[model samples]
Target: MNLRLSGRIRVSVFGVAILIAAACGGDRKTFAPPPEIFSEVDADAGTCADRCSLDGRSVIRCSGEIEPCPIELACGGGSCRQPCDAVATEGSTNGCEFYFQPPLLTTHNDWPYSCYATYLVNTSTVPVDVGIEFEGKALDLSKAIYRTLPGEAKLAPHVGAVMPGDGVILFVSDRESPIDNPRYVACPKGVVPAVLRDYYPDGTQLGSSFHLKTSAPVSAAAVYPFGGAASAIPSATLLLPVASWSKENILVNAWEAWRTYSPGVQIVASEDDTDVTIYPKADVHDGVGVVGTPAGVPATYRLQKGQFLQLVQPQELTGSAIISTKPTSTFAAHTCANVPANVSTCDILGAQIPAFERWGSEYVGVGYRPRTGDEHEPMPYRILAARDGTRLDYDPEVPRGAPLTLNAGEVAAFGAGVGEPFVVRSQDAEHPIYLAAYMTGSNGDYWGSGRSWQTKGDPEFVNVVPAEQYLTNASFYADPTYAETSLVIIRAKTDGEFKDVSLECLGGPVTAFRPIGTRGAYEYARVDLSVGSEPGVTSDGKTCYYGAHHLRSDGLFAATIWGWGRWTSYAYASGMSLRSLVSTPLLPK
Candidate 1:
């Protein structure tokens, strides 16, 4: 025990910034310690006295004689200075255990929550499984991120038990479906304001950081009721050479095998620039192409097989073949609308296209959909306009900002969201955003023509169009309720300038709503529409769209667990097989 403290208590712990207390003549007068001079001692009170309530609860425990405490009478030594109360443990109240509160969520009062964490500043690493969703919900469930080795501290199978400030719902990927996880990143609700901040694995800002924010303007909505479910403790921020499409630079590549094989991928020119200039070879291949450039120079095509590709680089990227051997784009709308019309069995269905323009209008026009359902009930239908004649509908009373038309044979399915209604037209009354399209059969199921069987299992066809004899105009209205529906748009900066922007959608079934006019998601760090303009529009106006099918089936009615069949019944009832769950049984490739 090295307990030495005498030369007048070593001048009172170095004069403690002068709280002297009456010494006149020599000039010295400071003293602050009379708030009832209290002191109590006892000990231990963990799990926070079972969630704190114990009425006037007490427990201090310091021991022996050290008294003196003029420094505000030792904060009175109660729970050692309030380790968030209930009763503290040691140091910073045993390093604070958990109580957050702002906006994260997964299950809440029901449990099974998720927003995990295990190392904010190096708890050794592994335990990173994040998912925290926010903009319009429907992330479902996701897991897999625990990868560390360097120093090796471990213990974060996605952490858990957090409360500090609240606000979360992460869930980025559980094997496809928060609209097929295009690098997912909604994060909105409360924008991270609970407290206890200290990040760095690429999200930046560390030590004493926490949630904070008070200038307001965070809500994208959803803290509780709307669908209900809460969980938070999860957090994420990693992009790197971007998990690989080689690493982003085609400026855009809706999908031509990563802009003909990563001619260096990246996008977002301004609003804080990621550098934007892409054009090594695929200026516009599947969406419309120019191709040949071994020196040749037509350099100006139009691509359109369902739409995909948006590169942005200074051009000039020849190819000996790290990728573009060509031979891929049969593009029957992303593979004959993903077969399934009874094509034997396994089942498939794909089609995408969402490009809308008019905020300042600069020639934007693109709309397509076909993510049906059937191979054992896959479920998404989004089609919107399959045409058969001259019909069009969109009015919903017609007052709130006008402009609506398109009803012919109907074909509008925006992922079936029950009751339906919203044809289109917004400026935010509170939260409008609507646009529909539907069609999927090959047994994928969505049923149209001769309905009934509970309206053919109703995956939410919006009313299946047909409202007993067309003509209801007033602005047209039908959608009543189905809950989760998305296809929002508005990311202007030039052609109309909305202001520092970034508003995207694809949590599911709302594909291709463009406006990349650029405005920060980290400047478009690793964009991949497939390369520049999925439906094409951005010269400086921004807008790219694509949302197709995501049914995510898992029986027993399971709602989460990656949505479509609880990860294919957790790899077929646990026998596991996506090729032996990613395979490695001795490594063969």
Candidate 2:
């Protein structure tokens, strides 16, 4: 198996991302472990308490936890356990609240599309109040504030509260409700959900989206609508706060099945006065970026703290890249596109593109549930060149449409047939490409594949995190509407020679599992998270990792959770490897 991230190549321009630690000058570099990890310090029992494994080869010897700690005997905390039903008000220590769009579960109008943001309270003793506040919204995870967006006009808050081991949801609807229209702000006091009456007596309306302020740390995610006026179908993904923000970006307009389906790139500015620039491909250039003068002629954009920009495009924007003076977060999507090419029906495609600073060179394309029907229904892949001349070598050699090289701002796509996973590598260490996977629209309908049934079985879009961002400890909450949820685990290297590389799914109902597919240079595991039905926990059996379940591995790897339900489908990577977490724990309780 090839352990190197880059393959041998003559490519010349930079590609999507390079999982770099901040370098001294402008020249970005590949990843190296922190110096403390390289030190020969033993797992000293003196500093360690509950012998916690770092999961898949990491170096943190556990003692204190930023996530919710259990009030069990081992940690030395006496049982002060009580129901967490307190309402959030002044003096609460819970973290600030944030709101992002989930499928609108609140409306029959939003039906066949059950979009809602699912959040989890990880603090065992912190029974914080949960509510929808529609003011100006700004979330700076660094400061732990999901404050109202300044100067925005009005809707009263809809409120509720939760204790440890509890999970709740807020439905998003754009149906001209109080939350969606400021005009209804003073309409009626009795319009509020009955369940929220005890929490906020003065509240009356539900916002299309909400800002949740908890007294403690929590986990939350948005189930991007599968198909929307803004996107194709309702889809799902995890939401990242400023703490998880990055400066570099991979911007690929999604693949288009219909000429009408336009792709989009959306970004959220984390800090105030952030300047962003786009280096868009004037035309298609496979595997290399435009030389010096062209690189400097990009379109520049600026954003205030908490503001976001969405750029929708056609196939022309595939290889575009975004660089910022400050850290920013981004999402790439299409209104809707067909999978498997020939299938007439289209589905939504989108994913949070991990910026260049958070990217890895090694990734294996794997997916959720089962894909059946025609062998022609292939997995469509988009590879965005971070730099020019990125030499791409693929396993199983893409059966069709693979490109030999890519220029910066250039994107190349090919189909990897269903169930067959493949690996991609770049020749140079600095030039890494972004890899994304798309499900097929029901293909093969004409040739005995029923045309009516040939509609894509709800196509999905997912991002594969690179091994450069792989980590040992990750945690998150699962979507509640989806009955089936599983994780596709990809380790950078194979270890059949040793005991199988296992990811210990400590919290929720997950089990310690082994990889089912080991091919080329990577080993892949399908972990049954069944998260919608269970809770998450960290490596320590007692700590409730809750919203974001803690994931540990014996080797470095990345995991993405895919949710499939009656009418929804979506996927997102775990948060352990996010560069922001390097300094802060995900849920600091």
Tens-digit lDDT track for model 2 on 1-589? 1111112222223344322122232222333221122111234545553222232111223534323334321111111122222111111112234434332212222222322334343433455555444335332222111211111112223244454434444333222332432111111222222112101101111112234555544445555431222222556655544444566665666565367555555666756677766655433222111121133245555665545555543444555566678987676666666655556555566555655655545556765545344334456777776665455655655436666566555666676654566666565545566788765554433223444322324567777666555654454555443545666666544233322334434433334433323343455656655543443334555322113344544456667776554334566776434432122111112
Q: How much lDDT does candidate 1 score?
A: 0.18
Q: Per-residue lDDT tens digits of candidate 1, residues 464-543?
A: 11111011000000000111112212121221222222222112222233322122110111112211112322323433
Clashes of each: 127, 80
For candidate 2, the clash count comes to 80
- Quick one: best TM-score, which candidate? 2
Best by lDDT: 2
lDDT of each: 0.18, 0.46
